[model samples]
Target: MVVDGTYAKMWISKGILYFVYKEIYEINRIMAKQIVSQRLQLQNENSYPIFCDLRAVKNAQKQARDYLAIEGAYMTTALALLVEDEHSMVITQLYIKTSNPTYPTRVFTNKEKALLFLQDYKE
Candidate 1:
């Protein structure tokens, strides 16, 4: 993942390595590149889940929603999220609402609780 920011970090946990870059505004060129590259690198593994908290970021624009939706779709990732504010929930719902055919995402205020339910989730 390529990022022009104050900090770029990647955290690996439970087969999902989350790459977080400092937020940028007005353009999604850099962020989109990172997500696509990361997903490709994660191919042939277990689920590549992504958890994003946008409580303090700039997301007044509609592209933010599309960005998350695209990430979920392309990565086929099951998403788990915690929303501490309305702004974050707005973006979260956008992703949840999309509901891609290949990607199934779940939202939860409680991660541990959600995980327990997911353990028994069968389609």
Candidate 2:
């Protein structure tokens, strides 16, 4: 199943949930909640490894990051963040360092590597 939200597009394939952020959007707390809610709906109570493509995201507020790290982890087995540019990389790194997610989470510059990482956690 696939779902498109204000900040990103989400889909599930195999046992992985994919979230691809829209180009140049600033994510706030409310947006984070909405995104996670949508993801929960898509998953339908089944947990899955998540692959998030954040290459296009411009900015993410600290509240949003915190909410995602805590609340957004529902129905998620693990998380793989795909980043291309330095900006996205920094954001991903910051999220890891500051939020300290309970689930296994990693950042990758290569999509294939990210997928391979998430595959291990797929249900």
Q: What ranges in model 1 sit over 4 Å off?
A: 1-8, 19-30, 42-46, 60-64, 98-101, 109-123
Model 1 whole-model lDDT (C-alpha atoms): 0.49
RMSD of each: 4.9, 1.4
TM-score of 2: 0.92
Q: Which one is best on lDDT?
A: 2
TM-score list, all predictions? 0.54, 0.92
Residue-level lDDT of model 2, residues 13-101, one tens digit each, is: 98888899988668899889988888899888999999999888777888988898898888888999998876777767886987778
Output the lDDT of residue 77, model 1: 50
C-alpha local distance difference test of each model = 0.49, 0.87
Count steric clashes of candidate 2.
0
- Residue-level lDDT of model 1, residues 8-107, one tens digit each, is 3444455443444445443354555555565555544544555443323443335644564665356445555545555556766665676453555665
How many clashing residue pairs appear in each of the predictions shown?
0, 0
